[model samples]
Target: MSIPALDAQGVRGPAPAAAPRATTPRRSRPAHAPGRVKVWQRWVSPLAALAVWQIASTTGLLPQSLLASPSTIAVTAAGLISDGTLPAAIAVSLQRVAAGFLLGGITGILLALAAGLSRAGENAVDPLMQMLRALPFFGLIPLFILWFGIGETPKVALVALAVSFPLYLNTFAGIRGVDGKLAELARTLKLGRAALVRHIVLPGALPQTLVGLRQSLGVAWLALIVAEQVNADAGLGFMINDAREFLRTDVIVVGLLVYSALGLLTDALVRLMERRALTWRRGFLGE
Candidate 1:
């Protein structure tokens, strides 16, 4: 037994057990998780792919008529830049997509809010949306063209139509999937609907809503491609078609690459938003 320890005032008590040092909890790193790779490492595969393509082109291993190699495509792309056709097409296409995306995205979010917030809203809105959602978004090109004519209106409308469904579905599901207990707690706190949505509902739905945004963007690009291909267009699609008539495979390849790069760029943007928006979560992303 330990003897009591007395202070200057002469207190009697069992010797205070050696005070255990306060320790901070150590965070465990995920297993088999290598540290973040360098940014250049992410480009390794694509660079290697380009190298292979270049080799094949230089060796004449691939038919230039059928498949223009990376170097040829690069040369064509450079020429297009010099000529300004490519740049103008890019501008026109970007304008159409931006307009369509804004219109469709807003419509989707609003409808989702209406449906998610009330049973009556769901009954009134969901059926019509579902019916339209059933129709192939691209297939409506004919109708859109007939109604809006073979113009920018049909192209933009097609993109908007294609984009809206995914956003609506994902936003609706995300809002509805929020924890019921949280809703009850909000009610107990006498939170106004506006405050309730701002503080809890919207935050809960953000992850999935972002997912929908990504999907909608992808669909928007797809719709743009199809819509542009449908008529006498002033976009990349038109350029690609014109190149086909000239048997300019390199130009076609360049157009395809530009489209791909646009998709990748936009996807990267959304991913950046996701990382920023979901910073509070701790998981695979290590946010």
Candidate 2:
């Protein structure tokens, strides 16, 4: 027998097939969904590391002399800061890095442009750059000390040398890698050399040039540390060397932390500059 329906006010009939089911399972959020992480997500691992370090230090698992606790490092750093040593050292190192990087970067760009555009320039300069790039920056330290007499000049020169080759190579590669059809079109259009280079070449090569600049900046920062460590009268590296001599592990720890922080800051700035410079390079594979 068919089921009977009551009036609208007192309906007692089977529900319609189209009736919404309140109990239906809603879609679950993805485990690896983008933007799911907090803005401060990167701090989690570092905070965990600090906690573990604090625990290890409290338990004496790590010798005080060998691995100073975070508190000790902080105290030492504050003392250094209060005495103006840390700031002075940082300033000196940064000045050296800036000078060297600017000099080397300009030379690299000019060399790369010449090589990319001229066969003679490439034949003359590329071999020398490749050889120089292959040589270790540390290996030149002694030579630089000898030639430049272990002064600020030598340190700056060494850092500059360390930074130049990568920029040169990447820039040259970028220029060479530009679309051949575009070049041919420019030629067919009777574009002047200056116009072609300014409008076509520079834009085409900019993305890779930015990559090179980022890479070179990292190298420059590393080289600056090494350079500062070499009989330096004043710098973070010198502080580290001095701390080692005095067996002040806390001081040593402070120097290292400062170095790491400075490196991170510089690298971050370079990355920001890269993002700004290469805004036209969005959505590429492996970006």
* Per-prediction TM-score to the true structure, in the order listed: 0.80, 0.82
**TM-score of model 2 (CA atoms):** 0.82
Cα misplacement distance, residue 251 of candidate 2 (Å): 2.2
In model 1, what are the clashing residue pairs, if there are any?
A: none
Per-residue CA lDDT of model 1 for 141-218, tens digit only, reads 778878999878998888888888999999999999999999999999999999999988999999899999999999
In terms of lDDT, the best-performing candidate is: 1
Off by over 4 Å in 1: 1-61, 283-287
Clash count list over all predictions: 0, 0
Tens-digit lDDT track of model 2 for 194-243: 98898788889987888888788888888888888778988878888898
C-alpha-based local distance difference test score of model 1: 0.84
Please give the lDDT score at residue 74 for candidate 1.
Answer: 82
Candidate 1 shows a clash count of: 0
